[model samples]
Each structure stands twice: as C-alpha cells, then as structure tokens.
Target: MMNSRDFHRSPSFTERLSGLSTAFKMFPFIQTGQRILQPFLEKFGFSVQEVTDSVKLFLTNGHPALTFPFLRPPNNILIGCANLLGSKSAPLQFSPQISQFLNESVGKDVVYVSFGPYVKMSGVSWYSQLVEILTELDLRVIVKVDKEFEKEFPKSVLPLNWAPQKDLLRSGKIKLFISHCGNNGKMETIYYNVPVLCIPQFADQPVNAELVKVKGFGESLMKEDISVRAKEVIAAMIANHGTYHRNMKRASDIVENEPGNARENLLYYVEQVAEMGNVDYLVNKVARQQSTVEMYNLDIVVPVVVIVIVVVGFILYVLLKFCVYFSRKVGMAGFRKLKNE
Candidate 1:
C-alpha cells in the first residue's frame, strides 16, 4: 500500500495485485480500529457492527461524476452532496497584488497553485524546479507559499501567504489549477469545471490525482519526476486546454444537474433517522449479529471436512489390508503346490 501511494504512472498488474493484497490485509486493522473506537461509539448507543454495516447511510460531499465509475456503491450511500452546505460562500477578497495580476492577465492565462495547509513546500525536493517552471511559463501564476519561501519566487509570480482557493477556482479568471489533489480541493475544481495539474504528496491525494487524469479533467505530477516531467505536462495541458475544460464542464454538469438537491437529501435522511431513533433495520442485521464461527459456518464446515478426510483414510486402509491378505493366500497356495510336486 505504501509502495503504491505515490505512484504517478498508470498502475501495473503487480501494483494492482499488491493493492488487492493490501485491501485484504486492511480489514483486520479496520476491525481493530473499530474496536479501539468502541468506547466512544458506545456513548452514542452504536456498536461496531452498526457503525460498519452496509445498511447505514453514508453522506459524503462527493459527486457521482467525480468518483470512479468502477466503484459500486450501496443503496444507502448518498453521493453528490457537493452543495449540502449551501451553493455559495461569502465572496473572496483578494489582495492588491492578486487583484492586479488577475486584471492584467488575459482570461484563461492565469494559474492558481496551492498545496493545501499540511504540506510544507520547503521540504519538497522539486520545489526549486517547480518555482523555475512557474516562472518560465508565459501564464501569470498565483502561488500560496510559506512565508520563508516567498522571496524565492520572482516578481512575475504572485506568492501569497494564503488565497481563497475554492472561490478562486469558481472565479472565471483561473485558467488552470496546480493543486495537492486533496479531496475538498479536487471536488471544488470539479465543481467549478477548472482543469488541474495535480502534484499529490500523500494520503488519498495520489489516488485523487490519478482519478483526475483518468477522467480526462487533468494530469498528475510525481514529487520525484516534477523536475523532469513538469514542463512537458504543463505544455500538454496548455495545448489541450479546451478538451480539459470540456471534460470538466461535463463532470460539473453531472454533479450540478442531478435530479435532487444534496441539502434536501441530507435533511430527509436526518429526519428519517430522528423519527426512527434506530436505523438498524436499514442494514443487514443478520450478518452483523452473527458470531465469527457462525459467520463463516466453521462449526458445520470443520466437522464435515474432518469427517470426509477420516472416512477416505479408513477406506484406503481397508483396501490395503485386503490386498495384503489376498497376496498371502496366493503365496501359500503356490508353496503347497511346489511341496506336493
């Protein structure tokens, strides 16, 4: 799992197999995590089974179009919750430098770059190469950087302590987004129909980056390969800008034009849960209620398996004995004939 976490290229057969093996290995740890959280979960009158059951409805801020098509979600999973917290937020107020950059640059000639809060750019090995590439690009760049790295960028690039990321993505000025591919950031880019160049660092970021590429909304950059591959990728994205925009627009429409509103869906489910007091019936209670032995039917299976093995062994033993006895009888008859002669 760790091996595949930062893979920038398409996964190979070995990597896919490793992922499968990792998934199998993850269940026990997931169960252990559930057990560890049992004490806190019990306070809410929920058990490990109830928390882990498939019947339990999951409300995510993800849209169906943004998610991989191969994923088969259960009926209880209510996706496309992108705007559950209301569609819009307070308008973003950009700094004087940022505003000036946006005003001066032609529409779709500006790029917004951010790695979210957790990842520090200073520690990244390809940071210098990234800065150089951004500087050389004809497009105007707005980068959210740590204060220490602010002086590293040239005056041509606008380096700020922070920027209104989601608002900027929504704004018509941003031509491309250079992001860490965090879930919220990825969702925002998808929602706004903004093409992205993913520079995923860790966690689910790489997977999200891969999905972006697979969906044809954008491409991804590896930490190690950023120096070597960044320019080529950025050039390709620039050349194929319209195609990316169209792909993203289609995805955005899917998320936006879905039949029901996410806020309404959330409210309806909440009301149902409140009225019912217990949503256990929604899940497969029989499977959850079963003991480990009963779940796998080891009680019945183990005995049957053992009995079959023993019975086969006994039959083989009896056949061996009969063969020995028959051979001895033939030998005695031959010996008597020889003595008589």
Candidate 2:
C-alpha cells in the first residue's frame, strides 16, 4: 500500500518507469528472513527476469479503476476487485450468536473493533481498559474475535467470535470502527462510509491505516500505545460530529459512482484474458539463453554451498572424535581404579 501521494497523485517519471523492472516490484517491501537470502541467489547468476517470466500473471484484489486509478499504469497490476460485490450488496450473516449480539445492542452507539478476522486482541488488560473507557463515554463496543472468551464481559461490550463485518458496519447504530486496517476491512469501511480507528497489526496494515488518516476517514493509534491513546483517538473520531462521516461518504461515492468504476473494468479485463486463452507469452522464453558468466556462476554457487557444508561436517566430526577419545580414557581409568579397590 502506498501513501495517498503515491496513490491518487502521479508518481515521478522514474518510479513509473522503474515499475517495468522486477527490482522495483519489491522496492516498497522488505523480504522476510527466509527470503532475505534471495539476494544471494541473484549472486548465483539466477535471473530475476527468468523468475518474473515464470510467474504467469499477478492481480490485485481491489477495484483499482475507480478506487485507485494510478494503479492502471505499470501494466502488470490489475484490480480483481473482490469487495465490489459485498459493497454493492446487502449485509452478511455469520451466525446466530453474532446476530443475537446485534439484537442486544439496539439503541446503543457502537464502535466496532476488529483487527480483521484473523487478528485478535493479544493484550487482555489493554482491551479491558479500552472497553471501560468507551462504555463510560456512553458508547457501546463490539470486539470481533474468532473464538469465545470465558470471562464475563460488561453489558456495554459485545465480544463476538465472528461477524458479518460488512453488514454490521452498515447497520445504522455503528458510529466508528476500530480495525487492523487490513485492505478488506478498509474497503468495507469505505463501502459503508464508516469512520475508522486503525490499530494496524503489521504487514500492509500500517500503510492502510495511514491512508485512513490521510484521506480524513479516521485516526490511527499503534497497538503499543492503545492503552494510553485508544480512548483519546476513539473519543475524537466518535465526536467527529460529521467530518469523518462526510469525507468517507464522499469517498464511497467517488469509488462507486465514478465513471468506468472498478467492477466494469475488472470484468472487461477478465473477459479479455479469458478470450486470450490464458496464454502469457512472456513465460515462453528460452531458459538456456544466458551469458557465460551468468551460467558459470551457478557452478560457483554450488561449491560455495558445498564448502560450507563440508566445513560444518568437519567441525562436528572433530567434536565427536574428541568425545570418543575422552570417554575411552575415562573408561580405562575407572577400570584400573576398580581393579585396585
């Protein structure tokens, strides 16, 4: 996820042009430790170009045509737009339990708290304290998790194991959403024009949360600061009195009512690709075409890996040999002592 400056605003010519390169694709990203060694693979003469050609196609899950048109360029990225249907449809139903919780919260103003379906509240004290503050402010709370809590919670709070998030956010009583700032949750908030209070939980969450603030849809607080800052942020947004609400509504209309909205463009591309028989000609390139140095580098990497393995094996061997030698000496000494006794 890019900042609004990179999303709605045009990128510099360099960034746009760099989009054509594979290195640029991972530029906004950091490789996890497992993949951190990937740069060394490049030193082995492995071509990222070949890897790029091997992966047939890539697609995004957002409706970029209307939501973020700047994504239209760089040709490789396309919007699959999974949320379009949910946005265009009615609220969802997860289970009787969540439905009943909604029933119990009829007249109260709710600040729905969910860090996506997969994320959960890891801090019991912080969460419990946040609940106290919200209820004291006369705002009800909904904490969505994947499992039931054994502890009895206050009447002002609803700890639902699961929820039809789109439906719940659209419900008239919802005043604010406390979310993980995941893309799907962000889209739902946008769909319903629900103001958000983002407590992003890593990955692209921080970026999405920043967008929520940047676009004036809501505020954000780090999870670490939630204990001290959650009440402050929540109060500010709930009291927004129409700023976040109005801005979000305007954003919703912009994404949905805009000409050539994402849904249509997404379908057009799908049909076009389908008509093309799912062929990606780029993947058809010859793998053997390479420079002498690039090809020889594979041989170089083989020895490097093998030499490391050999060194490790030799160290283990010496350690084992020492253990055996010492054991033999101790055994002999013990046997001699026993005989003398």
Candidate 3:
C-alpha cells in the first residue's frame, strides 16, 4: 500500500513514500511498528526471516515481527489502542499526580510533554522556556526531566523529572500527550485515547508523527517556532476534542473489539516459535529473487534489440552496395555506346 500512489496524502509535495521502499517501516503497523522494521532492516542486506508485524509481540517479548506477506491486509491495520489495556512498564510511582491538575480539564487544559531517552533537552534553560510557554497560555503541563531538574514554576505547572506516563495519560484530565512519538509512546497515547502533540527527534519518530497526524487524532510540528506552534496546537487539540476524541475512540474500538484481541495473535506466534524454532510451515520459503533474466528480462530484451540493430545495419549496407554497383554499370555501358558511335 505504501509503495503505491494516490492513496496516501503526503505531508510535503516533494515527499512521497511510494518511491521510498524503506518508508513503510516507519508507519504504524497497528501495534509497535516491529513489522515495518523487519522489511527495513532486511533491506540493509541483512536476511531476517521475521514472523509478525504487530507491536504486541515486541512489547510482550521484545520480539521482531514475522515476515508474512500474504496474511497482512492491504489497508492500514485497525488494532484498537486500548487492547494494550494500559500495560505500563512500571506503576504510577512518581507524581504531584495528574489528578491534581484537572479542575479545568476540557481534555486540553492539561498537557504531558516528555522527550524519550534518545532526545536530550538543549539545556535547563530550554526546559524552563518550554514550561514557561505552556503556563503562559493558561495550560497545566507536567514535564518529565532529570532528577536534578529544579526549575521554578508557577503553581499551575508541575515539572517533574519523572512521572508514571501510563498513569498520567489514563487520568481523564490528560487531554493531550506531547511526546517524541516513539512507537511505545504512540501505543500508550493512542491506547488511552489521549490525543497527541508530537515533536519527533530522530529515527522513526518523524514517520510515527506523520502517522498520528494522518489518523486525525493529533498534530505534528517541527521543533522550530516552538512557543507559537505549541500554543497554537494545544489550543486546537483542546478546543476540538469532539473531532479528535471521536477518531481516537474509533481506532480504540477496533482494537478492543477484536475477537480475542492482539494478545492472542502475539501469543499464538510466540508459542509456535517455542514448539519449533520457527513454524516452518508458516514461513514463506520462496525467496523474492528473480533469475538474472527473470529479474531484468535481459535474456529476452537484449537479444531482441541486438537482432533488430543487426538487421537494420545489414539492409543499409546492401542498399549502399546496390547503389554503387548500378551507377558503375550504367557509366560503363554509356562509355561503350560512345565508342561505338
């Protein structure tokens, strides 16, 4: 679906995923994007005969998804967000608690912002500036920082270096989740039906952010114009909860309503792997290779081209010889007639 055209709306006019074979690896594969990764990682000349594409497998076992081409649907997958069922890496251990900041929550009043482990804040000043901007817009924000972060803040802002992310998002007060849009973060934000405000830092984050934007549940922005864009996006997400929440609910419903849900699918494959290092029957043994001729069709096309060129050249050479021979024959006959006269 990705490497084709007219179906997906590209963010930039010049950017098209259809031409980029590895681009799909960044799209949400309805779970954690492990499925997308296998194809991409394999494109690097590494032969990974993977098994599944859903995020459930990765989160549950840190497993790479299997490469099953036929079974996957052509359209975007519809696994519900909540099927993850708020499974946090740990519990709600740190907080002033998200609940404490909820009196004005219209789902937009409070925002949660954390750049995951990979993205470092520019410095303490940048962190301070971010907190100041949100509070200036009359918003309640909790920023996850380091244990040593000691920025002074107004009572409305809670700047904790750490907090229970799943707990905060589950709190009804959390209207928006501002993050780097990592796959795990995407799963958590969407599963809880919390809308997103993404500022992607690196790797697949940009692709993940684009996925969120396309889903109609959230918005993505460049790191530039931080103060203005943050205010603009936060206001929009809060004010238009009707639209965003509806889309979020629809996506979650699909996941939650699955007959046994994603967990069963993940377990099914995992158990099979345990019984046999891999289920030989399930893995596609056919390599997608083309014989030198089958791949480029050089055997057929090359010979045909060569034959045409030879035939054309031969005809031209004969035509030139005939013109030369006929002209000489006429000249010799004319000379003989003149001598006789």
**How many angstroms is residue 302 displaced in model 2 relative to the true structure, after the best TM-score fit?**
40
TM-scores vs. true structure, each candidate: 0.66, 0.62, 0.61
- lDDT by residue (tens digit), candidate 2, 164-225: 67778776568888878887888778768788888776666776676677678888888689
Give per-residue CA lDDT, model 3, range 1-341, as digits (tens). Answer: 22223323222322322322333343344334554465677866553333342222232311111111212322222232324543533355333454555544544478788987545564645557667778888887877776556556777777665677877876556767888888788877776678888887766687778777877868898776575676777777778977877877776666555575666665666676687664444322221233545323354557768999999999999999999999999999999999999
Give lDDT for model 1.
0.71
Model 1 CA lDDT for position 55? 43
Off by over 4 Å in 2: 1-57, 63-82, 85-107, 120-123, 278-341
Error of 1 at 245 (Å): 1.1
The local distance difference test score of each candidate is 0.71, 0.65, 0.61
RMSD of 2: 15.5
lDDT per residue (tens digit) for residues 53-89 in model 1: 6346667656667765432223244555345234445
Query: Cα deviation in Å at residue 185, candidate 1?
Result: 0.6
RMSD to the true structure for each prediction, in A, is 13.0, 15.5, 13.5
Q: Which residue pairs show backbone clashes in model 2?
A: none
Please report the candidate that would top lDDT against the real structure.
1
Question: What is the Å distance of residue 219 in model 2 from its true position?
Answer: 0.9
